[model samples]
Target: MSDILLSAAATAACLPYPALADELAASLTDSAVTVPPRLVQPLPGGASLFVMPANDATVAMTKLITFTPANAGTGRPTIQGDVVVFDIATGTRRLVLDGPTVTAHRTAAVSLLAAQRLAPNTRGPLLVLGAGVQGRAHVEAFVAGLGVREVWICSRSPASAEALAAHVRTLGAQARVVDNAAAALPDCPLVVTATPASGVVLDARPREDAFIAAVGAFTPSMVELGPAMCRDLMACGTVVVDTRDAEHEAGDLLQAGVDITALPSLAEIVRESRPRPAGPVLFKSCGWGGWDLAAARLAMLRVCAEA
Candidate 1:
């Protein structure tokens, strides 16, 4: 077997949002793929690294592997990443991709998938409570996948919010910048919290018919939504998570006094035949290794085809 290699620039040229979401969803729902246990290492400087191994019988003869290393230092608190793809059958290295862009796409795709399932009838101005990479990606994903009419972005820095909003408008989305989260909450039926805050940023009770996607704070020490969000989730629609194990380990739910018993896995939500509870729905994702592997594999395939 021969292996293919791809760089961050090459991968970006081939991986599109809609296609990535479709591929990831199929891999996630299919029973044939085998995703191995992820290896995680926390650095002394407060950074973290993760390695994921995966294979899908329908996709290729060789298994796909991906490595992601993220760092959020104390001073800068930057989240930088890198992805490497290898072909197991040929023992060849396929690609070295940029982790940040790939992560933004895949994470937003997951959020969009969750929103599609959980918030079927949602409309009006959507609220994004972060202006970082993830925040911009979320807007792109939502515009591509949902029926959002307008977007309101809130960040600590007004300039950052304005910049992100400008980008969103270029993508054919009606967008605006806001100074606070509360101002955006009242009119937003869908709220996404993507900040890197170590404490709560959105504390108000959600609207009766809203949906929330909280993707920040993957570690035990960080949080973007407070106890009120958890309590709201319990009382409202289903709480879907990428993996209950990851959430339990990460402390996003546990730290907020959220009962694990009340949480439902993403698979459960997708398979449910009956009507779900009324009110807002919450989908909290704590980055999973399987997602990285799946996305990397797809990106690598594109690199090979181009070569």
Candidate 2:
């Protein structure tokens, strides 16, 4: 077996969104290996820290280090971090994957994957409710997965929204910047919320037919969806998660009074479902160790091939 290690930068350079998503879905459904649990720590300095560790036979080992500082000076409570990939077989450090970029792509891809299974008939005009890195990744992954025809980028910052719209336009997708979240919501069948907000950004009550992907909140102290969203998810379509253990760390679901018993595990969704979901569905991912290892392993293969 070829032993290859990749740094974060190198991994980012080699891993593209479309290919990564394909690899991720296959890895997620694989029955051979067990995904390791996430390690969470309470930072005494006022930051919440989380570490996701995993290894596939080819990838060797991978670790994703994430930090969410207390919302003191900043209005947003977002995650910031890095992912390190190592080759255990050779004792070689492979690469440091760009935490922000990788997180954005992987998270969005996860949403896209869930959307693919949950809402196959919904074609966009997709609405993205954030203009940050995560939002951009959603746009990329959505187009890659669903052939999104148009995208409406909405954000607290008009200029940032315009910038993202312009960037998306360059990718040949019809794009526009919108200031009102409500105005953007009705035009699209699919919505993705990638903001770092502590409360609901979009009203989930009115849009009963819209499929949503919420990937922003990670801790019990932060929330993005309101009670209505959780209620709808619990009652309507299947709410798929990467792992139940990670959901315990999410502030969005816990604070919204979501019952953990109602949500279905990802593996169950893949194996038990028939014809998939036809109506509104929601996927809340807190990230998982298996995805990190899969991405890292793919990046290492590229690095080894180049060598």
Candidate 3:
């Protein structure tokens, strides 16, 4: 058939947090899915072009986007592009989904899946570091998908933090803006660090049994967790990576000298059906193309059903 374009709103509407999370959970165990290493090419002015492609038995998908760090606070999005989906049999483009929307929702859905399987508690008052796009997506995921009652937001920019907190409040969850995210760690068992930090944001040690999802700092030079805290996470709790890609991209665990190979993949945890560990659970997500593929599949299904 003809190609269909889905805007940001339409893309998000098709993949709600609950259904998206379930799609990701199922894709994790589907052996037919194949995601290759995404290509990141650096451009002048500190911009990056990312090309991520994946496929299953039915459709092939590619997400092409640009990441411009200099755009922060400039009213321009740092990530922008489109996800093109094609029929595997015909090789004809079937759909085009908003790139950043797919990235934001899919990433958050992955985090939700990890939390549902790993977190000690999915209840309220979760602490979130960073108030950017990822930060907002995560808050919506936790509150809507996991039924969190309250959210504690922290960010370097006061205005941004308050914005996120305000959004959280509108979602019917209590929102708190904190000057020190580390200080709020003990009370908020479920924590997410979505900051694009070159150093550390969460410097304090985590509670013995807290669940933390570190989504920012994908490169080795960037990190959100302090060395002491990273070490403590491994020593006192189990650290899981969303995929093997974290070994190369997960700065939080790498900078702390944590052996990523020793950690189990999220797929393993899902398949084995193991009991939750007694200590803290740190889940490091570094992004994957299969997630975008899952988004495409869901969007197509929803679109077709509507048609």
| Most TM-score-accurate candidate | 3
Q: What are the per-residue Cα lDDT tens digits for candidate 1 across 177-215?
A: 877787677688898999875678988877777888888
- How well does candidate 1 score on lDDT at residue 289? 61
Deviation in Å, model 3, residue 133 alpha carbon: 0.6
- Stretches > 4 Å off in candidate 3: 1-3
Per-model TM-score, in order, reads 0.86, 0.87, 0.97
- Give the better candidate number (1 or 2) by TM-score: 2
What would the TM-score be for candidate 2 when compared with the true structure? Answer: 0.87
Task: Put down candidate 3 lDDT per residue, 1-307, tens digits, no spaces.
Answer: 2348877988899889989988888888888899989999999998899999999899899999998889988999989999999999999888999999999999999999999988887885799999999999999999888999899998999999999988998999999999988789889989999987657888788777688999888877779898888888888888999989989988888889999989999889888987777888999998999899999999988888988
Query: How accurate locally, in lDDT, is each candidate?
Result: 0.71, 0.71, 0.89
Error (Å) of candidate 2 at residue 37 is 2.3
Best by lDDT: 3
| Candidate 1: residue 6 Cα off by (Å) | 4.2
Error of 1 at 53 (Å): 3.0
